[model samples]
Target chain A: MSLAPDEVRNIAHLARLAIGDEDVPAHADNLSRILELVDQMQQVDTKGVEPMAHPLEGGQRLRPDEVIEEDQREAFQKLAPQTEVGLYLVPKVIE
Target chain B: MFEHTVAELSRLLADGEVTSEALTREYLDRIERLDSRFNSFVTVTGEPALEAARAADAERRAGRAGPLTGIPMAHKDIFCTRGVRTACGSKMLDSFVSPYDAGVVERLQSAGMVMLGKLNMDEFAMGSSNETSFYGPVANPWDEKAIPGGSSGGSAAALAARLTPAATGTDTGGSIRQPAAMCGVTGIKPTYGRVSRWGMVAFASSLDQGGPMARTAEDCAILLGAMAGFDERDSTSVQREVPDYTVGLGQSLEGLRIGLPREYFAEGLDDAVARVIDEAVAEYKRLGAEIKEISLPNTHLAVPAYYVVAPAEASSNLSRFDGVRYGHRCEDPQDLEDLYKRSRGEGFGDEVKRRIMIGTYALSAGYFDAYYLKAQQIRRLIADDFARAFEEVDVIMGPTAPNVAFDRGEKKDDPVAMYLSDIYTLSVNLAGLPGMSVPAGFKGDRPVGLQIIGNYFDEGRLLNVAHQFQQATDWHTRAPENIA
Candidate 1:
């Protein structure tokens, strides 16, 4: 369950967090310890247990699927850090 | 002067003994004088509160207003309030003034409840203690050196210290009940979907439920009436009609079956806390409630399962906090990747980052089935345990925390120990049932809480039981004398 330095760095990248070089060792150690604990779950017998997606039963308890308000994308987009022509701007993946 | 419960304040406000302006100013001054020591509030809305008080007075003059009208209360910083800075105790939302009110805020405001301010909490509602808050740890009003159990610690502390009559709190795991227990107040986490999470900042969506924190169960019932509803905006909002929460406050507990979960009362429970809880249960027996020894066999897995599932959901929920959104962003970045990384890194606190990392790891491609899927399965077993136990008993009883509030630095270094602090309370959230904590008795100088959990949509019954306890005991009315 030990996460190597490089693996920790990769996790930091995927999580979009900046980890200082010194902080990495501690983060890796802490994460390693946590994973060790989480790994204990595998030992428990959960063969026939059904997965619980929602705590409440009766199939998601969803509200009526009706439009309550008009679209406000333009107004909401105004709060974004970077946007152009109603679309959010992000680092270019293609190019 | 500051010891009035919401019920007492309502009577005074109704009888013209206290003006809304006077009541609002009294609590505001108390918060001003004492909050620096406790760090209970992140943002104190003085002007708006005064304005609301004046309007409430005008409503009273016009001969229209309810018991809660003009009564001041605080909200956990998680709820988004229109024109107010609603930072969920994180630097990520340091400057985020919400444009719209959360459903709970709007509903309570419509009830004419004056806003005292926003209380501090764990960032994104992630921690068992309030130390994770960017604003700083909330001091337990009983002992300033001790920690206030959280992420509803501020509301609990403030209410316990008489800063606000009652406040709104969202419980994802132990957030509401744990703090109420630690701070010697009464609070309830209503049945899931009973209160809308529409504009409340998301943590673990399925588990996050907003309810009320107050000094007494009756006061909590009044606040619950204002906060509970079915909102069309929130996809999971229940469609059931709201009930008058205070209707059954005085209901007799005769023939009520109180279940004592063997797992909850087993090892790791502190002797002092067990004694206090047993004393409270004994009182219920004397009140004619039948006590039963029921078993929730899967209780031991609650903490492990919650740690995995909560963080997994949090990892997905917190992805919205990248640089290209409203919240904190880095000053400058070499590239877009740097922007996303540095912005998120500098914004979230250590505990939040730790949860995000744990969540990311569990949800990763190779580990999803082993960690995330397995945790979900364990969650079902835990809920099923409660379901079976509830079928045999009307309510479940236990100690809210393993022990009373510890010193601030006691569990700071050990996250697992802090996580274990929530063991008895997390199963209720995982089951999506109504649960409450009422002041039972004292352990040494600190007060202890007896947890009362009810089945789904059984909030009225839970409050009635809590009210019945408060009626026989005056523990809920006692306040810490030296708050500063």
Candidate 2:
């Protein structure tokens, strides 16, 4: 299916990405191609086939809830783009 | 010395013929002198490598040298290396030094392997050509104008150029195998869950698997021994005892049943590449193996299903890189939404953004059933295709890629054309089975790879099969002449 520029903008918005007006045509072209590529799935008859989430079909391995990790916030925050006093500093969401 | 395999370097160290420090220094010098042409490494940890080599030598003096002691290799930049930049070949993480080591790095480091440094890769392991790498595209050592197939291109290039004896590579749909084929090296992507994914940056979570890239199957076996194991940290990591991959190296392929899927040999395969693969199969037959023509009817659908599934997971995983906590940040964002959108917009490349948007669209309301669920159903068919093929044969044999490495920038603009490059290798990842590419022969000056696919957790058997082939042929030993 061909994607309109507005549809492409909607997707970028939903994906939290910013596509410039000039880049929309390129995004529309590539995304449409990819969709076209994956559209081959429509030819296959998957009647009654369950969605395969895992390659091995094994369920997620579980462990008891416990503290397996130490508090390394300071060490981890060292790479943060903006952190202040052990807290990540992001743009305010509310006034 | 630079051309020596990992196993050879280990032997040299064991025989007291050379010190680890000397070997490391020799490799460092080569990287310093020659790597400029290939652009294989993003960071060369010369000082740390020398320090580790000295420590390895001291261990030898204390009679505690391990089998892998003093052997030097590189980690694909995708694997987090504590205190070192694990850029994953993107400008996003170019300045981010991981505070913790990836599971693969921890294992290799504990095995007494001296790390040369982090190798370059396609940004976030997204592209087929390594051109997506913010550091720059890695040059195929065979021909400077050609690409080393990616997203593990840097790892393959380093091994082919003899800049490093071995390197760690993660294959989420042929990243390990394709690059190995293009660069004339050997690489294996173990069954999904056979290797821990913890600390290895996520691509397609279900498809991503870490494996070894080396000069020979034997070296890959040795490194695989260290790299594969159940890690509790990775919820998806299988709980299974690791096998000694080398123990089966000398086993005869006499009675081995090799399957050639009819679908793999259909259209799109280059004539020259198919001819080499046919020769490799003939070699296996000569080694007492039997070949069967089987059908993986859903093979045509694999690339499409993969494009859907991989991107879906990648979109979710990459959402973690919103510029606040770490990685690339946009300067002076107007507000939270702007921070989220612009940081991601500026940080990611076109391929990555395209995938994220596609994934988001597929997963969005009203489209989920048509796209994501439909893709998953096709995924089952693809996996079942492999399952049936495996039942008829011990392993599947085919060309690692449709063609040899194309010239750099040839398909850089065409996303679909680039995606087709991994068609042969993608299904294995889809099935979460073990796969490897061994040096089969050359197409002109470029190498063609013989892809070997094994059933789940049958990595040792696959390595043994590759080992038998290497023993019979000198193809894997043929190094790039300029580097050699």
Candidate 3:
């Protein structure tokens, strides 16, 4: 149930987070403890039990396909880190 | 004036004893003078609040005013406030001013409540104590050395200190109730989807619910009525009509079935808190409530299950903050991966990063079934436990937290220890049942809350139960010393 430093690094990378080398051991320790705590769930026999996702027992409410929201692109993009005329500016993914 | 409840303030405003503008100014001044000690408010919107108050006064002059009109209240920093910074107590959103209002904020504004400001909370509503906040921890009003239970710590502290007559809080696993208990205020986490989640920053979508934090259940009733309702924008919003929560305040608790969960009282519960809860239960019995000892056998599993489910959802929800659209961005990135990593790494605090990592690990390939699915199955069992209990009792009662507020930094380093504080309250969220924390009595100077859990969408009954208790006891009236 213990997470190694490499495993902790893998988790941070998978989560798209950067952890310092010194912090990795602590992260590994903490995550391991948390996993140990969550391991208690393993003791319960949940045979034939359905996994509950949403709290309410129903499908999501469907609305008409018609668009209702007014375009707030400029307003929304105002808070963005970087944006062109319309498109968000991010680091180049392709040459 | 500072000590008046929202209900009392509403009465005062209606009777011309106080003007909304004056009340707004007084609260703004109090927050300005007193909030330094408690670190309750993250932002105080004084000018806009006064303008809103004047507008409320005008509406009153025009004979168009509601019960909550002109009443000033703060929002937990989690709610998106238009043109105001809605930090969610995160460094990531430190500079992110929201473009629109949350559904709760919109509805409350429509009800004519003046906006005081945004209150501090655990960063992204992640921590049990407010210490996780980027704005620094909120101090309990009663004992400054003790922690105000969070992630709605600021809201509770502000209410207890009388900085605001009313405030809004969101609870995803005891955020509102625990803090309310610690600070000796009243707060309710209505049933899942009872209040709209639209524009409220998502931590755990299924369990996250917004409710009122005020000095009394009567005040909470007034606030909750305004906050709850079906919103077309929130797909999960219930289609049911929001009940007039104030109507049943005077309802007798005669013949009420109150179930005491044996699991909640067993080991780990503080003796003084148990005594306070016992005294409160005895009062309920005196008021004609039939107390029955019941068992929610799966209660011990709530924390472990929640640690899995909440963080899992939080990871997915927080993925939107990739530094491309909004939130904090790194200074200079060599590449996209670097941008995402450094921006997130530098932006989020330790607890948040730990959760995101845990969530990432849980939802990762080869582990989903073992972690996430297993937790969800345990979730069903916990919910079933409540379902069985509800069949036997009208409402379940317990201590809101294992113990009263502890010293600041006491459990900060130990996440597991901090998680255990919410053992009694998290199951209600897992069950999607309405729950509330009412000031029962004090443990030393710290307050103990008697938690009342009701059937799904039965907020009115929960309010009535808390209201009846408040009517009988003076605990809700006891304010922290030096707050005045």
> How many angstroms is residue B481 displaced in model 1 relative to the true structure, after the best TM-score fit?
0.9
DockQ of all candidate complexes: 0.57, 0.88, 0.89
Best by lDDT: 3
Q: List candidate 3 segments past 4 Å from native.
A: none
Full-model lDDT, candidate 1: 0.89
Chain B TM-score, candidates in order = 0.99, 0.99, 0.99
Query: B2-70 in candidate 2: lDDT tens per residue?
Result: 768888888889999999999999999999999999999999999999999999999999999988998
**DockQ, candidate 3, vs. native dimer:** 0.89
- Which runs in model 2 stand beyond 4 Å of their true positions? none
Could you tell me every candidate's TM-score relative to the true structure? Answer: 0.96, 0.99, 0.99
**Residue lDDT tens for model 1, B1-484:** 4778899999998989999999899899999998998999999999999999999999999999998899999999999998888889999998888878999999999999999899999888878779999898999999999888999999999988889988999899989999999999999999999999999999999899999999999998999988888887888888898889899998999999999998988999999999999889999999999999999988888888888988988989999998786888888677788888999999998888888999998999899999999988988888888889888999999999999999998988778788889999998888898999999888877889999999999898999999998999899988898853
The alpha-carbon lDDT assigned to residue B325 of candidate 1 equals 60
Model 2 TM-score?
0.99
Q: What is the clash count of model 3? A: 0
**Reference-based lDDT, residue B303, model 3:** 92
lDDT of all predictions: 0.89, 0.92, 0.94
